[model samples]
Target: MIDRYVRPEMSRIWTEEATFARWVAIESLVARVQAEHGIIPAEAAETIAATPGPDISDVREAERTRDHEVLSFLAAWTKAMPDESARWVHHGLTSYDLVDTGLGLAMRDAVDLVLDAARELYRVLARRALEHWDTICVGRTHGIHAEPIRFGHKLATLAFAVDRSLTRLSAVRESVAVGTISGAVGTYATTTPAVEAEVLAGLGLTAEPAPTQVVCRDRHAELVAALAVLGASVEQLALEMRLLQRTEVAEVEEPRTSAYQGSSAMPHKRNPTTSERLCGLARLLRANVGAALEDVALWHERDLAHSSVERVVLPDSCNLAYYQVTAATELVDGLVVNTDRMAENLGATRGRIFSAQAYLQMTRNGVEREHAYRTVQQASLRSLQQGTQFADELGKDGIAFDESALDPKVFLQDEDVVRTRLHERLREHGTVTRP
Candidate 1:
């Protein structure tokens, strides 16, 4: 991951130092497993385990000469260990065995960090949804007021989306939490399946059912796709913040710190900078998904095409996602919701926003469906043109109907019930876990 998107914990998991550390751990575990199976001397396994890990600088310097990361790492490792035990460092394993397994550990840790951020965001959204559950607002369709709806209802929908994204991320984590010790061509020519199982189990991973010199790229693709979807969810929330914070529809505003400055030239600007940043980063995440998909098709057993792409896409996507979730969480947590403005805006369209309720009430009062629809449509249009309420227009136009039944409050009468049900569902999904 680049420095710009890096969050300390997530960035640490993708560092060169971290990568080498994981490779060393995997090597140590493999040696112990081999020793247990009588494939290597116990003394050699003990010596290898006792050796200090290689410095990242030494590994990089070795790579400059070897032009192979695995060989370079192994060369550095041999230099650190006793001469006799050095030969047993990577005895029967192929490069992909260590590389892919180490990659799995790194990805698992990164995903865990992202999941923590997502859970926190989910809780923030759920709490805000409950807080605004009964606050009425105009529901818009085609950018025009359509009817009355609780603002909390809009937020509840977003909360449910966050929950679903978390579920998908958990599934993706399981898919990526696999390791393979199968040798060249996945034949296990020298290493045994038992050794692979034992080593992976010790690392909190499952053995890949099958591999082709590398773990299947489909797993990697799924991981990136999941992160892309998560990014899209965050972007959806940020986009809503941008829209609601618009000058004409100032129903919400992102937090502005004491030191915050929205613009250099404008004096009154309070731009949605954080929300816009999240939206832009989401586009990059989606683009990475395409690259991950392309990585799925490698020539025969494997190729280097997927390797270089994974180096960029995996860490970058994870880091971007983690940052987006945290940024969105802060935006939501400190959001300034203008409930008074929401109420005022709901009336901006006059009473035409309640036309559907009036139409339905007319039908229930024995008016034919078509007749009621036309009546309400005419009254609604007149209300707009004459700057009158829909109910008053209906009375003036001689459209006989029960005025009390067409009350706008009737549209939101069941709001409490709906909110209770939504809250119950969110509770059932459980509380967010902090990392």
Candidate 2:
């Protein structure tokens, strides 16, 4: 099942051989349904089911020459079926009958694989988040220190995002799991609507209430958008890891082996390459979402425009998302968070991070708000410039009455507020909730 360019599971879903195999299954199922309705000879339907699908090599060559996959598949399929049954194989069914139905099978299979990977990702994320529940790191806004937050809090939040994405993916699987055997214009001019219903039931899918020469593109578009959203969530986690691994803020890093070489010129580099790769591939999924959106607006009830685009977008989006999810789960499982470095870096600014808390306590103590703000700001800037502790600097200044009045420890006493919030927020790791 391996795609020539991706993991075996994903690649198999989009393989030329697999594509035709699903097509054959659809056509055979239709023949059997037709027989049950007395539209065709029951013996002929049984004969067709008894034969296997086309050989990959023959099907490929046929596709190359014919320039249409269904035509190629039909040619190979008829050749394999008992000669008498061949005439009834695709009777009264249009190309979309095979194409869209086969695609549903492909989509259903691919989604199961994606869900399996996402479930693993959830487990890894949850385990890691719990492991680092008490490991404090500096929280930042606009890339500057804001306050202390547990690494587990951020990891847990990412887990929740991924969980929501899984839910969306499940919904998409339901929406896109429709099949169609409606004729050229979906009015069933050439066949009974009962035939479409029976075929879909055999394929374990629901029949679209109505369809044209093609199944409505909105279903396919929704599937791709779900993929894109999942990719974006994975990218969010990767970007965070990349930022954490920056030279100035090396609080976390991806796992590296002794034999791993990051760069030829910089032997010291152990980059977050897996996370970066996920980030880059995520853009591809996003771009594919745009293409899926475009596919939704075809000319009239049907158009060839959606056909060519889906040929590329559908397979590639599923494959890419599968790869990203696998990569992200591994990255989360192997991530190394430097608790000591996080603590060290938090102290790098010499206690100025707690100045806001200090300012709040002064105000609560009945000091003028404006005066408290000015006092804390002056101390913070002085500490920032002179490389001195803000608390010590404030004590040395006549501004603060005495060392006893401004215990940096007292100002910092509110650290537990952040800790408590994190614990509550991460109570159920890998599960999203209303904030």
Candidate 3:
């Protein structure tokens, strides 16, 4: 994780202390489950459950000599307990019995935090879309003016994209929220499936149907892939904000404070730093996908190939995802929309963006397609080159037509239908705080 971009809540999830603490939790639960089956004495289970987690520093020091984290963690934990309980600790369990279960729980919680941040962003987008449902602006394609569209319509497109992203994350959460205690080779030669089930249930995880030395890597890869998609969506919106805040466009700006500085040498620069940062971080999140996909294929049942790759990519990807969407929420929810600038830019090409409207209207009124194209193209070109109004050029040709069709809002005539559909969607997702 980038230290400056590290979000506090997400940062804590991947910490060594947190990881060690989860291991202790799993060990205690395993003991209790084993005790219920009479494999360990009930009093020993009680003592193990009651003991505080071992110091992370002690675990690290022990790991230096043992060269095994779970073993070192167990040594540090068991040394603090009486012989009777220490003997029962990790009895009939392998390292992954503690490690993978603990990891699943940590990933589940981290993804939950990401989901919460995404939901907040969804609500903000919905509310903003409703607020500006009829706010008209020029729509662009390939960085060129294409036609007129409501600014809110533009925002609603991303709102729906995020809705899909939310659905993907939700599904990936369940996929990765599995624990395996099937023992080293997954034959359950020593520990029974019943023990695995009960321990996983206590930890709020379900048993992986089958596992090798570790739970299947496909589940973990699915999670990273979803986060990468969400990161791309974040970049989509951030890039739009960056484009709109350009000096020539000046249609919107990310939230700015008085002390903000964009250029050190220039005084009049209010750059889209937040949006740019969001875009840049999203790239890093996407780059992790190849590493995650590579981790899906371990040698034979399992190997160390995937392990080292996951150690860096998984946590870092989650951290980057949470940071991007959370920061994007701040950028979006507080945007400074310059309506006057939007209107000015809409007309910057002298009504040429409405060429489609004229073309369609002509075609509908029984004009030849080629004739309509020629007439409208000529008028649009005349308006652009000679600085004359489109209607004036049309008037020179003596064509009687309703002037109302040329108005910007003519492009948003079906806004009511759009609002009704969006309202239903927002309500379905519980994001409808306002009508």
Among the numbered candidates, top lDDT falls to 3
Over 4 Å off, model 3? 433-435
| Top candidate by TM-score | 3
Give me candidate 1's TM-score against the actual structure: 0.95
Clashing pairs in 2: 1-12, 2-8, 3-11
Q: List the global CA lDDT of all models.
A: 0.87, 0.82, 0.88
lDDT of 2 by residue, 246-285 (tens): 9899999898777899889998878888888899889989
Range of the 10 consecutive residues with the lowest summed lDDT in candidate 2? 402-411
TM-score of each: 0.95, 0.90, 0.97
Give each prediction's root-mean-square deviation over alpha carbons. Answer: 2.5, 3.7, 1.4
Error of 3 at 277 (Å): 0.6
- Which regions of candidate 1 deviate over 4 angstroms? 400-408, 432-435
- The sequence of per-residue lDDT tens digits that candidate 1 reaches over residues 167-284 is 9989999999988999888889989998998999999998788788999989999999999999999999999889989999999999988998888999789999988999999999
Greater TM-score among 1 and 2 belongs to 1
